[model samples]
Target: MSNTQPLAGHVVVVGGGVSGLAAAHFLLEGGAARVTVLESSGRLGGKLYADEIAGVPVDLGAESILARRPEAVDLARAVGLGDDLEAPATTNAGLWTRGRLRPMPKGGVMGVPGDLGSLAASGVLSAAGLARLPLDHVLPRTKVGEDVAVGAYVAARLGHEVVDRLVDPLLGGVYAGNAYEISLRAAIPQLYEGARGGRSLIETVRESQRKAAAARQDGPVFAGIRGGVGRLPVAVAEACRSAGARIETDAPVRTLRRTPDGWEVAFDHDGTRETLAADAVVLAVPAPAAARLLAAESPGAATELSAVEYASVALVTMAFRRREIAHALPGSGFLVPPVDGRTIKASTFSSQKWHWSGAADSDVYVLRTSIGRHGQEADLAWDDTDLVRLSREDLGEAVGLTAAPVAARVTRWDGGLPQYPVGHLARVTRLREHVAKLPGLEMCGALYEGVGIPACVSSARGAATQVLGTLRRAAEPGAGQ
Candidate 1:
């Protein structure tokens, strides 16, 4: 093999999502002789999907990239999409609770209020809830041994109202999980580290706010491409092909096995069964699929992966005439607290969030609602027509938006978000330990790291690096001596 081609042999990446595409790109860049991507579905991009609504393209899955992190942004620029990046017009979010819309309290970490003045002024809490705030300052430190549920720890320090109104809604937006069950360390590591320091949460949040203000980070917290985030996969895939990677759709891997030579990946493509031997393999599919594929090699990893749970949800997008709506949208969107018994958990004023989605003189306004979360899948059982109707009813009540929509579309995502419960970090540690035993085998995706696009890309890139390192070490002269 040539000196530049460290990972010279063939490599296969199973799963055509952004993670898989990213793996292919990294592998090709790392000098792999040949690479192939196998995707079960006819399409790619997984949850980073987009579709047209009212003649305007809108994201049906993850729409925004957290700009605070550089991974997703840097990747987009690398793939020739730097000029297309667009920041949101607004970032304000309203909290719907107790029969009115309250402005989200400022100076909070994951909805944990840092300043009592802002919380009290926002009217997010009742007199009793406000009264409970000072107790956090004087009360004895709540013991958080190794790790604890975010809700349990926050509620003990603050109160249940804060957990329900603030923390739950915020956590739901990301993981669709219950704060009472999510691990503090895994879900909200910053807050977890603060709690571990033994200082009051209020003090911790205030300190965080002080640091944030000192830095004064400018621009929007999130950014999106002009067409849609879904375009990301297409661009990345094209880049991979330029680097000589083959992408195959409608290819579902049936089994994976480790061999003395390297690895064997068997799959069915176009009504034919096929197997390919590779110097390395990256499993970029979901947890369940990965667990099944890894079972033959490492049952322990499979068992732990099987134990991981996922959350499913649906997005209902509707287009309405601006004149038909009664209230002007003060922010990009609003979050619904679960305690309010609303069918829709959150609503994004799409037109307002992304300038390209609508025009100032345009008659139609596009907005989308998210429904169903962990333990809230019953709503998803209804048909699309019913889901659209329920979303309209809730939006009408929440924002006095009684106008009939000009057009509507519903997208269902089954097993979309993964839940990270207490002790999840420890479980992941054990999984990694077991996975390390098998060389030339690596796994990546939302199941192993954060659910956002950046996290998924980071995971995929890390896997590529690991496999490449192994191949490099094996190639060294007198390697086994």
Candidate 2:
């Protein structure tokens, strides 16, 4: 250990994903003596990517960031990349229901019926379904203390029609997992808060909207970068380096342990065994990876980490000529409700959503089709070619496309997005408490709090704050004693 180092301490951030990178950036900005980022893969930006297709950029992983979340936008602005931000070309996203496309009901928050009148008018639900919704207003609230699955809660309050028609598809698009497995408290806290507030879900959303309007600061609902969403990660990485953070790629952390002084991180760098000493560490990888790394040091945390399940998914990007598609590629994209029983879960009209995606005269269309879900990994077992074919077929059925795509690309993510299973928030809370007992250690990623880009950013930023605070405390005279 280099005792004379400025701030006289080292901080190690494990995992090269967005969360890890963001943490490193913050630590450097906070004036840490040494900040080392260990990434298992040769490249950074774990799942975030921008691939070229027929001379156009397309995001294969996360497509957009919710503008409402200030974390991502703030980080972008801090890195001088705010000018690259762009909102969705169109805000209209439809749901494929009963073999027909129906526009997603407006004013619904993540498929929770915020406005029954809007939901009813959308024709997404039948007369009986609409009538059953208000039953929630009169029905006695269940007094359950345990975390309940979102599927069950929604069905209990709003009937199975809402669950099957809206919740499942919307959640599937986000978590890529079954609604029955997701925790209402963990996944949709606002909805849970609404129920606790003694108001119907519709009333809660209406009130929220009213308050937001009064605030006059509700930002864009969804937005992406001009070049691609991946640019945000790239900018963050650059900022970290500029701020004096040392990032090491191809450095896979094998184990972590608590040391009397601080912490020890063991990793393999190109087949060489190496260990780093740090005053603090942040584990920002996925749940499974975090579980494996923390098993020896914090078995309780490891168990909770392993308990969180993840779903595999693949993105099939296909491009078509301007005149190839029969139906006009109007809105941002469309989602396939599980009721449709289709291979594709959703498709995003990339070209239409972002101006930089294609040429003006070319009318190039980029479609991102998802595969795999809870108990449906086998659906993604098909070869890349077959997946492309199936995606094309599904798109043709949904949007009347007849022409062959000019280019096609496929990216597979095995256990990519974490599923916030029932009691997930409780488990995460317990894990965080356990980790706190181990001095100079932190964890952040899609598993703990949220899975979106903004969520990851928030977690990272929070971790950085903790690290900086600890450093400041330790620097005080006789502080460590």
Candidate 3:
């Protein structure tokens, strides 16, 4: 170890996804001696994967990152992807409800209506739903103790119609879980903070928009790499390797145990069992995988992790001859509310939304639709052909799009998104308490913080910071004595 790089000894990062790779990067910057990333799968990026359709690159996993949050975009720039970052060509999304695709009403926090006229204009809400909406202003404050499901609180203040047609689909897009079961505090803290004061939600969201707009924010709300956001993790991993981090793939970690000075990680490599000692460990896998690794060392934390649930989803990406559907597809895409009994939860017109995907082939158009959510994996069980057929059926109804695709690809993310039911924050807090009991240890991923790309990177950075702090403190004079 170099004297200048004085943080600590070797650190093994379990999980080669973006989180783990980014953790390694941060640890290296924070002066960790070495970071060995172990990934169970052959691929490194976890949910950030890519495949081409019609010879044009497309993200098979998450397509974009929330640019409003700096973590993900900053990470991209740090890893030499600064020039590749591109904002969506169009953000004119819609809500597929009431048998028509209407413009998604703007200036609301997660589909909570702020402007009644615009929402009413969109026709996303029926006449009955519209009538039931204003009741929120006159109704008594719905008490939210500690935490409450977003749908429950929204339905109470507004109405089930607002939740069913609007909030459900939007929350489904973010969480892949039922809105009625998602934790308000963990999911949307703005509303939770207001709920603490018993203020009307309409006023809360309205003021939030007002403040946001007044702030003169100049950038796009979201961003993606020119080719595909999937390239992000690949770039990050390369950066990690350049910084002296060793990344291992298809090497599944079998166990994690405490050591006198640090920790021991056991795993398989080339059909051979291998062990590595580390001064610290960063566990960045999903809840279940993390639970399994920590089961022996931290049973309480493992048990709590085991209780966290996940949702499965599949994306059907397709390409078509542009002339066949030119001028037919408009806006970015639309979100589907499960209440409408739609097979697909949401659709993004890739060619129309991203300039790179659109400019790739002038004659060909590309798009994708997502299927399945929490407790809704039955649709995902269908094979690629069946899944594509059903998704096309929904698309046909959605935008009258019936052009035969030149190529189609289905990407299924099984147990991908972690669910945040009511009390999720509390559960996470308790689990962290358990993890905190074990020094030289920390946890991060979509499970601890928000589930977006920025959130994941943010989580990784947080873990790296904690581990670096501990290592540096231990390196202090006579610290252990």
Among these predicted structures, which one has the highest lDDT?
3
Candidate 3 Cα outliers beyond 4 Å, as residue runs? 1-6
Compute each candidate's TM-score over C-alphas.
0.96, 0.95, 0.98
Ranking by TM-score: 3, 1, 2
Whole-model lDDT, model 1? 0.88
Could you tally the backbone clashes for each prediction? 0, 1, 0
Weakest 10 consecutive residues, lDDT, candidate 3? 1-10
Model 3 lDDT per residue over 234-344, tens place? 998898788788999999999898989889999999999999999999998999999898888889999999999999999999989998873568799999999888899
Candidate 2 positional error at 431, Å? 0.5
lDDT for model 2, on a 0 to 1 scale?
A: 0.82
List, residue by residue over 1-481, the lDDT tens digit for candidate 2: 1123356669999988889988888787777888999999888887787667877778878978988878888888888888988877677888877777777897777797777777877788888998898788787766435677889878888899898889999999889988888887888886777666566656766777677667766567778887778877778888878767788899989888888889989999978989998999998898888889888888998898888778899899888887767668658788887776899998888877776675433767677788888777887889999999998888777877778999999999998988888888888889999899887888888887688989998999889889878888899999978
lDDT of model 2 at position 380:
89
Model 1 alpha-carbon miss at residue 58, Å: 0.4
Per-residue lDDT of 416 in model 2: 92
Model 1 alpha-carbon miss at residue 156, Å? 0.5
